[model samples]
Each structure stands twice: as structure tokens, then as C-alpha cells.
Target: MKIRFPMRASVAACALCAATTLAPASPVAALGPTGGGPGAIVRPEATVPQPAVLYGEGTQVRLRSGAHAVPDVTALSWVVADAASGEVLAAHDAHRRLPPASTLKTLFALTALPAFPGGIRHTVSAKELLGIGEGSSLVGVVEGHTYQVADLWRGVFLNSGNDAVHVLAALNGGWEHTARQMEDKARSLGALDTTVVSPDGYDADGQDSSAYDLAVFGRAGLRDPDFARYCSTARAAFPGTEGTFQIANTNRLLTGADGVAPYPGLIGIKNGYTTNAGNTLVAAAHRSGRTLVVTVMHPQAGGHAVYEEARALLDWGFAAAGHVDPVGSLDALRPVPRGATTGAKPKTAVVASTGAPRPAEPDWTQTGTIAGAAGLGAGVLLLGLRFRYKRASRA
Candidate 1:
């Protein structure tokens, strides 16, 4: 159903998907199959970071067989981990941070999801729209449109819209404040590799994240049912002033929009790209009883290189599940206070990251007071998938 952007006498809708993506301008160390394209970041095998879990004999044999051939894109980095146990199964340049493109939205969502409630409705403002960067992707939000908190999230996970994120950030507080909260949240999740300058992940001067951290985001986000639902929705009618339009997910693995088939048992997570970040993806899948998350970054652009690499890793992870031993853990959500809960259903264990500011706005559940009634409604807050040689994703 459409979130219902009323076609009343109000502001008109303009080109929504006109936003642009960021391009990597700097050079860094490279790690690729053919040693990567020219000037690609390369790190020696000895110096490259390793995952927490060491591969077992079965996994080692799988790698040696080379029959599946790990994703061959150069400067490509990835990690595979168990969703339940926090065990890292395999990794390649897992900690080397690079431009994250839209994948950074995962952290943004984590930091902001709790502030607004699903039924909460908010109207767009010109000042809020001003912050969205040109050339960034959007879901066609008109300036005068009134939308539900749920509608904005659909724009985010489904279309990877810069507009949707901006609206949420504005409703929470100010752009700068929301961003500061996100950065602090990253360190608490142990995703220290991330540096978020732009919330929508449009390559800023120094925005970066690691495949390892992405896995952490995916695993952590999935713990929430709301996050899981948004990622799993393949297509939905995004709200608009005149009418709603069907917006499909940017994640091709889940949609099977490209040559790839809908991965069996595939869920949702996220996928992103920028000239700088190349094509990046974070996916979750379940074959049997085990759920695995895979994050791949900076694979060759224009082809399904990122997804293929992630799938190969998934292949190994599932086979290595019981066979391989974990080298480390994906840090648990900061523990909750002894008596204070995070409003999470089933009571998931998560704590606010140190130094992060809690939004002061009132939510639908908290009170009838609406966000944006007062400067972004103070004190309010709340808050991919690709591939496989033959695999799936979770959003």
C-alpha cells in the first residue's frame, strides 16, 4: 500500500532520484586477485588482517580446491561470520577501511532507529531537503508531503534514498548531531574502522568502513524485527505528493533483477556503490539452522564481482560451520542497563555506545507529542545483501 502522499494543493514533487554518488579520490594499499587494477590498494599477505575464526581443515581444503574460486576482483576485501555465535569464519583485508558508499546507512539506521515510531507522521521541510547532496539516490519525496516514519524507512532500505535519511536526521535533531551520534555508535559496536562524515554515505572526504564492521552491522541490525522487515521487503510503493510509485530494492541479489537468481533462503541486508567505494555489500543467509553474514567491499564496478565473492565466502562458511574454529568474536551489543531496556522486543541485549547522545524527542509509544514540532523534536531517537557464487543476503 502507498504511504499516501496526499495530492492536495501543496508543494509539488520534483525529480527524486537525482542525487549522485561519491568517488574515491585518494589512493591506498591494495589487495586483489591479479594484485588488483593499477594504483589499487595492496597489502602484503603477512600484514593483511585476519578474521577471528581460523579456517578448519574442511574450509582449508575448500580454499585449496579452488574449484569454486574465491571472488577474483582486485583490492577486494570480505569477511564471513556466524550470526548467532559472533564467530568470524573467514576474512580478507577485513579491517582495512575504505569508502563505504551507501552501506554506511546501516550504521545510521542503528543509531537512529529508536527515536521514531512506525505510526509517527512527519511533514517535509525545505530546510531539511537542503542537506541532501546532489547526485544521491532518492525515493521521490516532495517538500510539502506528510509521511509516516515507516514510509521514510521504506525509502531508505528499499531505494537507498538520501532524501529519506535526511528527513529522519532532521526529525531527530540536526544533521550534525545525528552524524555525531552515529560515529559514537560505531565504536561501541566495535566497528572502529568507520568514519562517517556524510550520513547517506555519499563519499565524503574521509567516510570509511570495513567489511568486518559491515558484518557487525548486519548481524546486529537483524536482531531487531523492524530492521529485518525493512531489508526483506523487495518492493513497495513509496509515498509521494501526487501519487505513490513502486520502488524496488537496489540489492540485485534479493530481487534477482540482474542475471542472478533469487538466492535460496536469502533474506535482506544491504548493497551500495560509489565511484570511490566501488560496489559494496553486506548479506545474511540461512541454509539450515545456521545464519551467516558476509560483507564485501570495493570489488570491480559494473559487474556482479562483489556478490560472487560474497557467495564464495558463504559457501565456505556454511561448509566450515562446525568444522572451522572461530578466531574472534563480532563484539556483542553493549549490554543493557540492569533495569533499563532499549524498547527492543524479546529484549535483545544492546547498550548505548559511550559518548553518544540520546535523542530527546517523544515517540508514538512515549507520548502523543510529534517530532519536528520543536527543533527536530528534542530527545527522540530510535533506530544488504548480495551474493554468493550461488548465494543470498539479509537486510
Candidate 2:
């Protein structure tokens, strides 16, 4: 009798074997004990252990030991924050305002995610595609194409498709209304210094924000795994009239030798560039269970330099905060009592009360008693004077 296992089980076994084969070789395995290869048994690198809680919402990472150094870049402003602790590790004029370029898409994603559901279908119109003008890059979304909401999102994020953004905005509302919504959302997220003049981050006067605000917005965007996956993709395909249109991610860090390597634990946020903004980058790197967010805006050179700087900062943060967990029980820390300083005089207490109550009627009863006493004193004085006058006449 022939016995067979389920097809799913067979497929799963094959997938497991493939995964094991694809695992990276370890350093020790690559360099054998005696520097000979025939007897060497190779082993995969140990996976970096992640913290139980990688990132706490709104909490920044604390730096404990590593050198805190800012990278050399023309970035008008920048910030490196711990994604877990919400602690700002390093910064350079982080609040200084600058044009965000495509980085503003983070806000767009934040606003659009809640409005559109996954797998929702939307029809692209000719009017929506028209008058987008020209830009650094586009996903080339054709007019009159009906696409799913998920595909449109991939176009907006993976490809920074300006046309895709316009279509999304038009579907939600017109550009003006969409822009207002973006601004409102930014404000609600505590990005008070940010102002979005355009739905897409095209070169428009007064469409600007600070590096600190961008870091905050980047963290919020990363909270959504869908957005994170889209941002991290190096390339994506969308159905077109002729065939599937393939678009390369504008972010160079996702691909090539210049790109950020897939270390133990790595997740994507976003990267942007413009003449005014230079090569700006928002990178989130996770290692040894800690996640760090590095934002460099307007770096002097290209994206590669910004990536290198960001990587260095991440390494430093990991080393610094490796052992200490300052925020573990942050609630227990409180302000010290006043006058508790050594050699300081103890504070004196003074009794105090609210002002004296006003008299209801100026004390009318007291006025009568005062008036009677005055009249009696005057009568006594007059009698004494009369007696003195009578004595003077007799003498």
C-alpha cells in the first residue's frame, strides 16, 4: 500500500530547507581553526536577540556608553532618536525649518492610512492625472486606470509617485482640502512646526518642516507595518494598459552596494532628496533588540554619505545604551523636596490667611456706642470748667 503526506506539509519542508540554505555563513565558519577548509564545518551567524518590547510608543532610547558624535553633513538640521524611548540621542539644529521634499509623504501616508482600507478599489481619472506638472521622479500612473487602494499606496511610497499622490488626494478631496488635512494631521501628531502646502512634496514655497518633526512623523509611519513594507521595497510592479509597469524605489538605500545592508534586524522608514533639501534620509535600524531612528536633512553630498552617518550614529547609540535601561521604571523618579540641598538653610513657614471679611453694614451698633462715649466726655469737661469759673468769681 502507498502512503502519502499532505501537499502542504511537503511544501513546508522544502521551504524550510531553502531558508536554512540561504542563511548567512558565520565568521568562524568562514575562517577555519587551522585556516584549512576541508575539515571546517560552517555555521550560520547567531541571530541578534531583540528586546521583548522593541519600541514603546512615543518613548525615546537612552544613550548610556558610546561616543555621541554628530556626523559631518550640510544638513541644515538633523536628529537621532531612540525609536523605543522617544529619547533624542543627538541633534543639530533639529528644530530649524527646511523644505522636506518627498519626506512630506510621511504625513500623506499617516493621513491616508486611516481613510482608505486595504484592498479597496478606486478609479483613477484623467482630471486627477492632468496638471501634475514635472518632478524629480514619478511612478507613471496612467489616467483612467482603475487600481486597488493597496497598489496606489505602493506607488505613492515605494516609487514616490507624485501622480499617485494626486489621485489619492483627489479621491479623498481636492488638493487644497487634502493639504489642509495633512497640516491638521501633522498638528495633531505634535508636529507643530510643520506646514504642508502641497499634498505631494513638490517644490512649493512655504511647504516646510523641521528635522525633529520629521523624526516624530517617521516614527508614526513606521508603526504601520504596511507603510513600512512599502517604504522598504526596492522595486514594485503595478498593472498598466500595455503591461505591468515596474518602478524603481527613489530611495537608493534599499538597493545596490550603496544601500543599507540587511543586518540582524533592519526596517525601513523613508529617504528623500531635492536640490533644496540635498540628500535627506530617515533611517530606522534595529540591532541587539534596540531600534534607532536617525534623521539627516540636507546633507552636503549624496544619499550614501547620509546613510553612512546614520549608521555610525546607530552604532554609537547601541553601544551607549546597551546596559542601562533608564526608563524601566521612570514613574518612580520625582522632583526632590525644596530646601533639601546640603548646606542650605531650612525654609521658614509663615502663617497667612485670606483678607479680613468686610463689615456687612459698617458696624452700625458699634457706631452708637462710640457716639455715646464721646457725648459723656464732653459733658464732664463742661461741668469742670463751670466749677472753675464760679471759684474765680468768689476770690
Candidate 3:
């Protein structure tokens, strides 16, 4: 189905103006418990505090004995983490960088989710329909097809579609803007080692990430309800097309009826493969109410081998830890050392120097008022000019 997207100048202008107006308010709403604005949250400690029993001498020996070993995994690296607690269950070259292939699309989908309006209908442009010819997979989105933003998300996760990624990038702004946004989003999410050069991971230079970073991205992506729904689909119909396109999930474990044995609670995640980065898989599984995420890159065998290794690691985790919750209540644990007492009256600040009161300086309200008036005047003049131009063209 062909779709034509009509870009109305007035609508675009209004959207830009609205975004500019609301941008400042966003930071205020992101404030933390300390009442500091966005980006002011206290940094997490570098090392987790281990229990005295666990930290005692020779405890490291016990940890080594309990470590799970992966088989047929040739990747320079791998990482398995607890989804709930964010604990590293296993690591083999986890920090080593490797091409993520379509797995990078997971980051792209997540970073763009907040920018897109839910349930909004967007027409696919001709430029977005053309797929990169670099041997990457595509969902066959044709030019001039109108679809909801939600459907584009399905294309990204279900089919690992490069074309769907392009459409999403265009929807956000463009390739350059989308790439920068992806980097910023990754940094904000604390995936410090990640770098995204392309919206679709198509073997582009500098477009690589570590297995550890991919696992982090997967965990964050799974948190979104829409993203989880799209990735978990065994099959879905692509709307606005001639025939219903059957999308088989790339994760093979989702295909089998018997739910990947030994693992017992495998949930859908993502898979990727390329010459530079051998078969890569990010698998998530749940058992006894605890969820674990495993990432394998450049596996010795195919994708299935990686899945089997992940299943083994998950089994070991469940057997050993037995669903120990990682997080604890801050209030129940310890309190900050600030002078203000908990639930106490606000303390008044006393100036050390004794001096006569000076007249308060003139407030800047008048200057601000003048600036606001000038800005309003300029907006009115621009609108008048646009209206006049439209009227003249109509005449």
C-alpha cells in the first residue's frame, strides 16, 4: 500500500513552538527525593556493600566454585545479569566491544519510544521505505503507507526491520538527530560504554557495543510495556499492506511449545547475527519470581547454542540464589547525614556577620516583562506575515 504524507507548514511550526515551550518544564518534573532537578540524583556507589559473611576471607573461593560455565560460546565476551536486582550473574569478556547487529535496534526502539505520540497515525514516506542495501533485514514497508506509531515499534522488534528503524528515525527528526538522541539516552540510562552511529545496526563503522552494555539496554527496553509486547509476539499482522505479513519472532525459544526446558521460564528477548559479530542473543527468563537476562556475542555455534548456554546459566542462578530480592527500602536501611531531622520543622539559617539591613536591590521583573513583550510582538508579526502570504497566494 502506497501512502502519501502531507506536511503542513502551520502544523510543523506549532509543534516546534510547543516543544520549545515545554522543554524547560520537563527537568523540573524529573526532580528526585532531595528536591534537586533532573540530572541531580546522587550517583550510586561504585562497589556494592557485601555482607560480612560473604566478604570474609576465602569467600572469593566459594564464588569461583559456584560460577556457571557457558558452553560453545566463542564470543570475546558474554554477560548474564539478574533483571530485577541488576546483579552480574556471570561474565566472560563482558566489557569487550563487538558489533551488536540488529540487537542495536533494541536501543533505538527504546530511546525513540518517549518521543513518539502513542496511538498517533503517521504516513510512511518514500525515503523511509528504501532499505540499506548492506545485507541487513527489512520488514518490507512500502512507500506511502500510513500506520500507527505502535505498528512501527512491532516492525523494529518482531522482524528486526531496518526499514522500520528508518521510519522511526524520520518520525523523530532525522538520522543525525536520532543517532545523537540514542547516544544521549544510553548515557542517561548508565550504559556508559555504548555508542550508536546508526539507528539500524548495519555494520557501520564505530557502531558497536559490549555484551554488558547490550544486556543493560535489553533490561531497560523490557521495562516498557509496549516494547515488551512487540518483542514477545510470536506472530503479528502488519497493517496497511496487501496481505497479512506473518512475523515469526527471531528468538527461537519462543517458537517451541515446551518452553526451553532446563531454563523453565524463558521469556522473549532479541537475536542478531553479522559477519563482524557472530550470532548474538539477549535472552530473559523468569523463575520463582526472579528474572534473569543473559547476553551472548560471537558464539561458537549458531544462535541456538547461545540460548542453550543462557538456559544453563539461568538454571544455575535459580538453583543457587532461589529468588533473593536485591533491592532494600532506603527508609528501612539507613538515613542520610544531613542536619535536618526526619519529619522535623525547617531550620532557619542565621547569618554570621552582624550588619545593618541594606535596601533590597531592584527586582528584575520589569526587564523580564519587557523581554516577554518583545517576544510576543515578534511572534504576532511573524504570524501576520504568514497569514498575509497565504491570503496573497490564494488570491
Q: Which candidate's TM-score is highest?
A: 1
What digit string (tens of lDDT, one per residue) describes model 2 on residues 268-318? 667776666676777776666566777777767553776666676666656
Better of 1 and 2 by lDDT: 1
- Alpha-carbon runs more than 4 Å astray in model 1: 1-75, 332-395
Question: Which parts of model 3 have CA positions greater than 4 angstroms off?
Answer: 1-72, 257-263, 322-395
Superposition TM-score, candidate 1 onto the true structure: 0.68
Question: For residues 1-395, what per-residue lDDT tens digits would candidate 3 score against the true structure?
Answer: 64422335654665566456434323113435655665566554423333222212211112445444333445556766666556664466655778888788888887888778659988887886565747778777777888888777788887888888888888888888999998887776656567788778878788788776788787776677776767677778887567566766767766663354433566667888777877788877776666767787876765366667666656665665633322211111122333423342222111111112222333356546655765675577567757866766697
The candidate, 2 or 3, that scores higher on TM-score is: 3
Residue range 37-137, candidate 1, lDDT tens digits: 66666654421123333222222122323234344444367777777667665667777778988888888888898778889998888988996777889
- Candidate 2 residues lying further than 4 Å off, grouped into runs, are 1-68, 257-264, 322-395
What is the C-alpha local distance difference test score of candidate 1?
Answer: 0.70
Worst 10 residues of 3 by lDDT: 348-357
Q: How many residue pairs clash in each candidate?
A: 44, 10, 3
Order candidates by TM-score, high to low.
Answer: 1, 3, 2
